[model samples]
Target: MGLKSSQIKQLERLYRRKIAPKSVISSQLVKDLCTAAFELGRIVGLLVNRRGSVENVILGDATRLYLPDIGRIRASSQRLRGLRLIVAKPKKKQRLKAKSNMVFRPSLYEIDHDFIVDLEKLRLDLVLQIQAHVEAESKKASLAIIADKGTKVEYFRDVNNISFDFSQFIAELEAKITSQIKKAHKIALIKGERGAAILIGVYLKTQKAWKYSLNELKELCVAAKVTVVDTEVQRRLKLDAKTVVGQGKLEDICLSALHKGAQTIIFDCDLSPSQLNSITDLTDLKVLDRTMLILDIFAKRAVSRAGKLQVELAQLKYSLPRLAKKQTGLSRLTGGIGGQGPGETKLEVDRRRAKDKVAKIEGEIETLKRQRRLRSSKRHEKKIPTIAIVGYTNAGKSTLLNALTNSKVLAKNELFATLDPTARRLRFPKEHEVILTDTVGFIRDLPKGLINAFRATLEELKDADLLLHVVDATDQQYVKHSKIVEDLLGDLKLLEQKRVIALNKCDLVDSEIAHKKAKMLGGTCISAKSRSGFKDLMAMCSQALWPKDIFR
Candidate 1:
């Protein structure tokens, strides 16, 4: 006789108590089983007694088992005795047949002895069987419930409940499944110290210089106090505009980031608003690009009011375009009193506020610029020539300034360590006096917003009598770095100013290489920490900033 719904429920309860605990049965498996049973219109279950014997095989459909090959074997003597084998039958007319041309039968000998079925394997086999049958009949995949281990039984109860709302159940099931997947792939918070981040980059196979850029990005992250736990790189002929890296490559990165418990992802190149949003959506981590990292370091190091204003302006300008709209389903729309105007998204409100703040800060900065121009005029009136030290970030510009003037400035091995301009009185040989000013360091691909915001500080360079371009002698890309700084100075229209090169950190490189670099850069090599070549550097500076007549 066909098993009724109540009997099938009893079988499920028995399976949960016996087979599920002994095997790797999950809620998904249970849901798949129920779905397959419902679609086939009949489920077959094997009821095995406690003594490991086949008892009774029950089918949801009342079809009789036909085993012509193994005429009814004696149930008492068969090895399958006391064990139940259940198979769901389709409500339609098609019959079930194994590959061996054997029609399914409830008889024990009809089952293959070669197959040693466990709960997990049995569940998979049943699912495959039902899927094949349904696909052949309907030509479409079946929708199955997915639940957690703790909630599978409750879900089944809800499905069977007289007042069950199938739509509500499906909605809750989908949400639960999504939440479970996200939880499985969720990034863990770093335990102590700074949060860990994954650094990712894309490069061309022919571009051997990509490592240098990635290294610079790592240094920038360090400056911002982020721990780079791992780095991923993909060599592609062309970059993917949507995600920066190829979809597969990005998936690998996301998996690695999850494994490493990283909370952020840092890209070597600046990402566009869409690209940034896409990557963030895929990875579910805080995404930062090179420009943002540099801006963050500047924000942290900015001390003076003018310096803070400039950093804030740059940050706002950079972030204004990257704001993403909130999902409507996740947000409430309000048009009542004290609410944002009608039809305006929270993202729009944020962007508007940022724009207003940018405008206000720009006005304040303009006032500061006038005050700075007046101060420069006063310095010029005193006939005190100024020497502005400039170079690629962390090239030891501030260190050189401190070494030459014997004054303390926050000199670190990090990039963009100094944001505020500091000028010290430097007396050269023969009583030649000049003001040596250390301006903010330059970097490759410096954001345009930062340059515009710091125009007042960079104005010191335009008024300088001579430029002391500090170069890190130990840097492998020192030549490239020198060119970048020169190009930027040219852009600032300070290329016409007289300049002297101070190749600092000479002690970190070979003497031969240092000499060659100094000759190539047309600068004097000096170890700022050791003060090895200061006398020559000072002599060169005095000669460039002050004429022989001034010395006399």
Candidate 2:
């Protein structure tokens, strides 16, 4: 088993070529700056929609319940509106010589050619054997590498180029090279509200957050420091795998990720564990599907007792089924906090124990739910017209809730800052008291685990008389945010309830921009930090929920 010089092998090399080489190009500063900018864009792509390809399965016209790259697509468009996402598909055609087979016999001089004829059969057999070998060799395989922990573990890698070893390079990088080709994500087809596709890494500048109307969503990313690659409303695409805007677009995402040295990818749509694993297996990067990102946000934003428990519950539930197909690295729960517990290893170690723990958590969550139910009953008895602040995560709902009531809710500039519901009674202009409840911030992709765990808390919104749908007016993809909230609300049957879109974070955008966005979204613009337009917003809510008799 030796390599011959005739074979050509591509090795992964760290190209240190100066961005603008002094020999041919000019200033190194420009080169360095441009290189830095390029790197920043690449990193943003990796952070935002790390999964280069997206394939969504729309369960209903209102919301995308299933995405191969993401688990769920919460099109939070209040009343849904007329958002049409067209996904173009290539026309299929049938081939003429479809099941053709051939039988060949060598022709030669009768007697003299007998030996040559036999030789031809030998050649044919050898060709068949070689074809089988090549096919077998092309399949994916695993590689063992020694990590910094001094632990030797086998990581799955593509099997390409393994059969013909290039002793010139180490096996690991070679494995990565093959793996990238086979599985490396190139085009991250992320969808915004309305099934709009956003390919961040390939086209959009990753360094910048989603701006314009997307400010609200952008702020969430900035607050969470989560990268935003791209957001789109795709109309047509493949249903089977769901990766790529299409095959060609997928190729582009893979190429883009490869060019920028991105080892991770994301999709706006939430993906199932199997979908996630399959994508990761193809892209060779840590695929952070939409649900994973939302979970990450929840993990980062969770603060209270119930919040932590709910987050843990959701994480465990979302994580369990995906357990069947996890990366080897995902199994190790050697660390703390996020990956501290049994983790991917738990699936390998003792699945029954993990299952038992999930059940125990469910039981505990039920107890919590009962407590929330008791609280809801109290509110019901009071007959108070409760106003629940609900909208896309990081839409300044927390900040506004804090400003209005001075309740000091954790209004950090982060996504999903308030996972648990917090309520406070506030006096209106007429001395009428109403309970303002801040529930979990909604996102385009909310994991089922989280929804299930936080049901007790979310039930607040269901019973509420009015919903304060906060929108970050400054974010570029605000429309997308609005849609996510709408879809989730619809899923909860809250859209039929009275609601007002409180466009928060108006300070980030100019008056002109704010005015237009407000008009388009049918939401009033205000900044919680500046305490601007609070009066009008309050009046709007009071007017919507309060009766003329109460005011009189």
**lDDT leader:** 1
The clash count for each model shown is 16, 67
Clash count (model 1, backbone only): 16
Write the residue-wise lDDT of candidate 2 on 440-485 in tens digits. 7776556667787888678778778898888888766789778888
Q: Which stretches of candidate 1 lie over 4 Å from their true place?
A: 1-23, 26-193, 205-207, 325-343, 549-552
Error of 2 at 415 (Å): 2.3
Model 2, runs deviating above 4 Å: 1-275, 278-285, 325-350, 382-384, 507-523, 550-552
Which candidate tops TM-score?
1
Q: How close is candidate 1 to the true structure, as a TM-score?
A: 0.68
Q: Model 1: per-residue lDDT, tens digit, 1-552?
A: 455787557555534433322222223333444455555465544444433232444444434322112222221110222222333334345455557865564321122221122111121111111211333323112112213431111111121122334334434544554565345334322323356788988887555688888888989987888877788888888889899887767765654554354668888888998898887766556789889888988999999999999999999999998888555453345556776535556776687799999999999999999999999999999998898999999999888888888999999998888899999998876666889899899999999989988987898799999998998888888889999999999989999999999898889889998999899889898998998998788778767765554432
Query: What's the lDDT for all of these models?
Result: 0.67, 0.52
Mark the 10 consecutive residues where model 1 has the least summed lDDT. 119-128
Given candidate 1, what's the lDDT at residue 441?
90
